[model samples]
Target: MNINKQKMIRNVLEQHSNGFYMQTQFVILHNRFFAGTHVHVMLKINNHFLVEHFKYIKLLQMILILELIVFKIAKDLIQYLKIK
Candidate 1:
């Protein structure tokens, strides 16, 4: 993510009632997901997961949808490699 976009997301997140907590959770989840970790497990570990808090947070929902798309592509690639 570019600096401006990062700033925008931070700004939006900071506007939430639980801004600091939400921001911290978002960063942690994002880092773990991009690091190739299982997002489901991370969410489970974090009890107060983002999904529950993200219902009204469109930006987060959009980001997660994109991440899911990337994850699907990666999974398909691995399956294809195994088939070869």
Candidate 2:
């Protein structure tokens, strides 16, 4: 993605990090399917109170992983199109 798109995404994540109420546990568990130990380590370290404090950082990490996966797929698709 371009810089503006990246900035917009970061802004959105930041805005929602506190009051955003979703099944965070489910998302964390699902993330294990993609990234294994790193997410596990992040979960292991944070206690209940610390989780609140660190929630934004955790969200950022998860989003970064997702963004990487998306960019990789986009890159592959572009290469395939060029070859065709």
Q: Tens digit of lDDT per residue, candidate 1, span 5-76?
A: 557765654564232234244442342333342343122212333342222234665455435534454566
Q: Rate the local accuracy (lDDT) of all candidates.
A: 0.44, 0.39
Worst 10 residues of 1 by lDDT: 37-46
Quote the positional error of residue 9 for candidate 2 in Å.
11
**Where does candidate 1 stray beyond 4 Å?**
1-3, 6-57
User: CA lDDT of 16 in candidate 2?
Assistant: 49
Candidate 2 vs. truth: CA RMSD? 14.8
Candidate No. with top TM-score: 2
What's the distance in Å from true for residue 7, model 1?
A: 5.6
Against the hidden reference, what TM-scores do the models get?
A: 0.35, 0.36
Prediction 2 global C-alpha lDDT:
0.39
